[model samples]
Target: MSTAQALSPSSRAESLKKLEETELDVLVIGGGVVGAGSALDAATRGLKVGLVEARDFASGTSSRSSKLFHGGLRYLEQFNFALVFEALRERSLVLNSLCPHLAKPVPFIYPLEKLIDRPYVGLGIGVYDVMGAGRGVPSHHKHVGKKKTLESFPSGKRSAIRGSVKFYEGQVDDARHTMMLARTAAEYGALCVNSTRVIGFLREEGRVVGVKAVDLETGRAFEIRARQVINAAGVWTDEIQEMVGGRGQFQVRASKGVHLVVPRNRINSSTGIITRTEKSLLFVIPWGSHWIIGTTDTDWNLDLAHPAA
Candidate 1:
């Protein structure tokens, strides 16, 4: 096991020196969740790993997420059982063993608007609960009558909401969760540095060998050599691929997701509420002192770094 390493200024300086002087077994691009997790995985296996990020950790889509570890109930409507099952299993692992301190079970109420909606929604939730059985969370869902629903969510429209089904999903602070992933990876001997941007790829004989990078903090350019490089840049994958002079095997498209945060009192609900929207599902999640409601999904082809709402 590797000893814990604090990601302090001194440690960062040391890591920067090491990154410049040493040859790495694996180098990871991006500081998002996937990239940080990849570094952690590689370092835990005793590889000399280095992770570089162009900005602060989790400053991208990793931070701008719904912050829910949910088994996509909407996917159930599409009959995607396998995906939901896998997601719930992962959710259980995260809540039960991975980062219980950073994650927990949050109950959500799927409000029914019509009488016929009960049986259908309940059946789907029942299957969801069953599929998620023994996966660390409460595996049963409860159907609440109209009176109970009103009692739980007084702000809910009495005339519109018929009843609701309550189920548990995992909640986490996505930014903190991602930052910890990077810190843990550093603890496991991964040389993680942010504010370092990869500008070009170092290639020989048509094979990638390393990267040409610049430290955005100091405006110093350097090269990092690695036996293997993994790109986990999320939406910026295509741009990274471009540095190598070709389109990658696959392309990445960015989807803009917009979420709104309002005071908790704005929605008088004891638990979260999930409802169907015309284009997609809507979530009114309970935050510490506020409720997070969103998101609108649409294709985005503008600036990747800064997207206007």
Candidate 2:
């Protein structure tokens, strides 16, 4: 069995932090990827760890992601070698070892509208696909002519689309995967409790120490002490730092991305599609009985909780 699957329910319960505990090896704030990762890493190393979140796990940017485990194709256009390589490696790990059940191969088709568009787009995508060859997902392939293209993607307007190129990428249940990370960390003995808000920081001799928090459910205050603390609150990161009485090093901007889900029959296509927009790449991802589209990225300042269309 996989390491993640081997983790039992009883082993996944948090027990490292007792109520009113005064000390711990590590305290992780924010229940997102990095925070949960730190807690799991620390706990696996035999350290007493605690992870507290003010809301449900992955209830922020993590859950609002595009849900793809891919090396961004747009990043390739900028010649970002390091970023592509790193992301490709991470994607491979996720598909092969990390969460095979949650992540799977997804084929996406790039519609070639013009005759000249094929060579240019195909060549670039070809290089990208070759780079990912032998990496967990399948290599990219192309199709031409109305018959072949229609055979591959019957839903497309054959008159508008000269042909299409088929490529494989990875998709994941982002929320489920992130929650699995938290559960895995708890299995390793990390004390994790959601709905516990961190109000302030605890200090001694002007040195950093623990956190003063309140249970949102019960409205009770408590102090969770630890030798070191990690902040992994994605968008609210700056807010957490401010409460600690320290100015943040860099500012974080909130970008809202919204996805619209429609039934698969609305846009009947054999494979998913990725098209270039003025500002961002638009993906028509297939999700079983439904197809997810949109993902409009707008500067959000009003309420980080919800993004307006």
**Candidate 2 at 266: error in angstroms?**
0.4
Give the range where candidate 1 is weakest over 10 consecutive residues by summed lDDT.
1-10
Residue pairs with backbone overlap in model 2: none
Provide the RMSD of all predictions against the true structure, rounded to 1 decimal. Answer: 1.4, 2.7
Candidate 2 residue-wise lDDT, 234-294, digit = tens: 8888899898776678688888888998999998778889888998789999987988896
TM-score of 2: 0.91
lDDT of 1 by residue, 1-309 (tens): 643456787887888899999999999999999999899999989999999999988999999889999888888878999999999999999999999989989989999999899999899899999988847676579999999999999999999989999989999999999899999999988999999999998888888989999989899999999999999999999999888887988899888888899999787899999998988789999989999999898889999988778
Candidate 1 wrong stretches, greater than 4 Å: 1-4
Question: Against the true structure, what is each candidate's TM-score?
Answer: 0.97, 0.91
Error of model 1, residue 235, in angstroms: 1.0
Please give the clash total of every predicted structure, in order. Answer: 0, 0
